[model samples]
Target: MSEVNISELNDSQVIGWLNRGGLKASADGEIGLWNEAESALGALSAAQVRTGVSSGNSLQLQARDVDGTSWTSFLTLTAGNTPTCAIDRTVIGATTPAAATFTTINGKTPSAFGLSLWDAADAAAARSTLGVNKHYMSLSQSSGSAIGDGDTRYVTEAILTTAEGYATRLYPMHTGTITRVIVQTSCQAVNGSNETATVYLRKNASSDTTLSSSVQFNSARQVYDVTGLNVSVSSGDYFTFKVAFPTYATNPTGVLMRIDVEITY
Candidate 1:
């Protein structure tokens, strides 16, 4: 037996070889050849990778079946957000993201950008770099003899007389804007409709500046706060919480109690 050069054969000779079965069959009958040809044609082609604007504020990255009947979605690139992929159909003009099975974000590494930002020597340095403020103040009664100017009692226990004007003398540790002034009381003033808790800030040796608006309290064992404030302050600034009960049925002695300040830099 010798190897035949098929290119050297004439048309009739080639036809003779074909009629005698030249192409090998992988399965029974000629069906395997047809299936192989169909598979080779049905596989994904480079020309099917498509990209275009299907609608306003929307995009389509799609593909279709080689049979020109069925379709599939490979990577659907959204406009406003990162690209996420899912499913096996082509629904062009997609505004919202797909079902979010395969998510792909477009920025950052190691969660907080990098590991070097968290490295610092002291607690203060670390707080500074991380943009976090840690300040806590539990101001109690100031050690004074009388009840008018030097009285610094936090109204819960020290408000003996209705005329004993008292407040909490606080020295701020951080430099920031006073965002919240929270007050906690054991009980409400007996007739404290006209009563209020006011905050004051005096930087260095300046005049007493009223920082935030007054917060009224009526509920017992509940939290009351003065929020939505932008009171500017610096370190070593003196602050005061004055609970004023101008008109009262019963003197709110043990009623007006605790004060907590919140700051943000």
Candidate 2:
């Protein structure tokens, strides 16, 4: 029969064969084992359980659900970052780290007024190159005359093409409407007299009917705000200004400055 000294053994070993399985101590003394029945019974023991770290710079957080179930992380470990760093939606903004492009309008010579069109050459600054559009038109001075009667009819409108002008850039608005017309002229007559000049808007280079008319080029810069006129302009519809020399004998020679027509939607 095997014998155990009571002083050197525990209650579990003493009553092992007599009662339900009891506690036992291992040789290493690191672990104390108990029987399944005794462990399930009124066993209330104190243990140094790890609740959280104290004064630790790094902390490990376990993801859990509302039901207290642990969950796995979805993201992979990245190469260049600190483990403690975090990214949240609250710190995010509307934009991203991608390149953005914008649209613009440009001006060219020969166009009576400033002309603009869509170009793809990335020509924004003065040094950048610009891609010219073939369909557009360009306007420039056609002829020069001495100071004569205040005859705006002497002004002419020709086809504005890329090859003939300094820059092949001009666009006509077919469906758009003519918002305004401005005519600049130099009355070289010695008297510097206020003269009445007739302005005309012709369709297709035919100086027949004036779509719109102005009476005087009193100053060097004559402007006619046609927004109230409500004139409809189409693609093929182009215009020219005419100067009527009422006092031709007094002012024999007259000079034409510029005629500008603006069409907008």
Candidate 3:
């Protein structure tokens, strides 16, 4: 909706950027004035990039649809340990762009990921080592298609101790890192019984990577956050979850899965 240029940075932001660069002008003659100008932008450095969330920095660029209800497209550069950058121009049903919209202009300084043409790389690959390759990551364990990787699931199978099947699958719409996976079921096993269902993240039916420890079914409402997982999946990868259940006296009804991902598109 609103956007301010990077030239309008405040005093604090300038000072922070200078401090981060360790820029100290050397001149004994001008020490009197130089000391006062410690907050000067003397170096090519920026300490903090505005965390563009609800509100924070002065330099921000945000775009919304006409109704301003759904976020049609927004390219917000968020600052954190994972200094993520996201740029989305998904105007699916539009014939032409509206006013103040960024157009695909040519005839400018072209950019390759590497310094030399021999050293080739993509945009996401270039920023991976800096830990900023991640674009946007979000999730809600609750049901809905509004979140980043929608957790809306429909597993309509009755699982008994005798049968275990591929109860979950994920078709990533974007390429990113899956940071977390939460699985909550309608049951948990008793202390003595071995009513356990081990879940795995299987891709293309090749190697089976265990998502979490064995999920035992006995209690009414048992939730398990899958551990030992930091899966990096592409948009084309077919990811299916294999649930293998051990012998049990009491069978479970269904399984609910939620995946929190850092999507870079």
Candidate 4:
């Protein structure tokens, strides 16, 4: 009979031989099967099998044992102790994150990312149609108006009066908290002792005036900026600007004015 030592084989060679129904003997020789109860077998050396696997390599189990235990061992590929596996979305199985759970993720803070609709809602605010939380709108009147002697008429709505040479324009504002309103006034020539121009912001019409500011023009052409006026506006509400001369003895030529409104949602 021929004898084969099991210690001289590797794992794959033993498995291959077992798959083909055990080892074959030389011609005209019978194979001898040695039992562990009768003979002692030597342990295989650790280096007898292949070693030194490449980095980022992994192993997977082929099957489980009868008791549901894994028979094969697997290598978990990682970089700097962190697993480099790609997790599928299906594996997460969560639709949304817990409250305040996403304040930071993967070492990134919320301020570093763009705000979504849900984020805006949480802050009790909303984005406009232009995807902006705050915006500035401006309206200007460039046509020259002459404030004649002793003119005290409050001009509302853009109207060119042939008798008084004054006009007004209506400004439509969006629904938001008005942060600031800046009114700028400029004049080319002033021909009166006290040439003062009063600018008033009227809500809805001429009667519902909310805020007003005045600027006095000297002998030379000058520009004035009126700022720090806060007012809250609602949807469908319109505003009008009234430019009136209170103490003008002679007409003021080349009068220009602009209004800037800052709003936040």
Number of the top TM-score candidate: 4
Clashes of each: 0, 18, 7, 2
lDDT of 3 by residue, 3-28 (tens): 43335533333212332332232232
Q: Give the candidates in order of lDDT, highest first.
A: 4, 1, 3, 2
Give candidate 3 misplaced runs (Cα > 4 Å).
1-168, 187-194, 253-265
Query: Candidate 4, overall lDDT?
Result: 0.47
Give the per-residue lDDT of model 4 (tens digit) for 110-162: 55334354355444354553357676776665464566655544432232232
Q: Cα lDDT of all candidates, in order?
A: 0.44, 0.40, 0.44, 0.47
Residue-level lDDT for 106 in candidate 4? 72
Could you tell me which residue pairs clash in candidate 1? none
Candidate 2's C-alpha runs over 4 A off are 1-143, 147-154, 157-174, 188-192, 205-225, 252-254
Better of 1 and 2 by TM-score: 1
For model 1, the stretches where C-alpha displacement exceeds 4 angstroms are 1-109, 112-131, 140-167, 188-219
Superposition error at 99 for model 4 (Å)? 7.0
Write down the TM-score for model 2: 0.34
Worst 10 residues of 4 by lDDT: 34-43
Instruction: Give lDDT: candidate 3, residue 231.
Output: 70
Q: Root-mean-square deviation of each candidate, in angstroms?
A: 17.4, 19.4, 22.9, 15.3
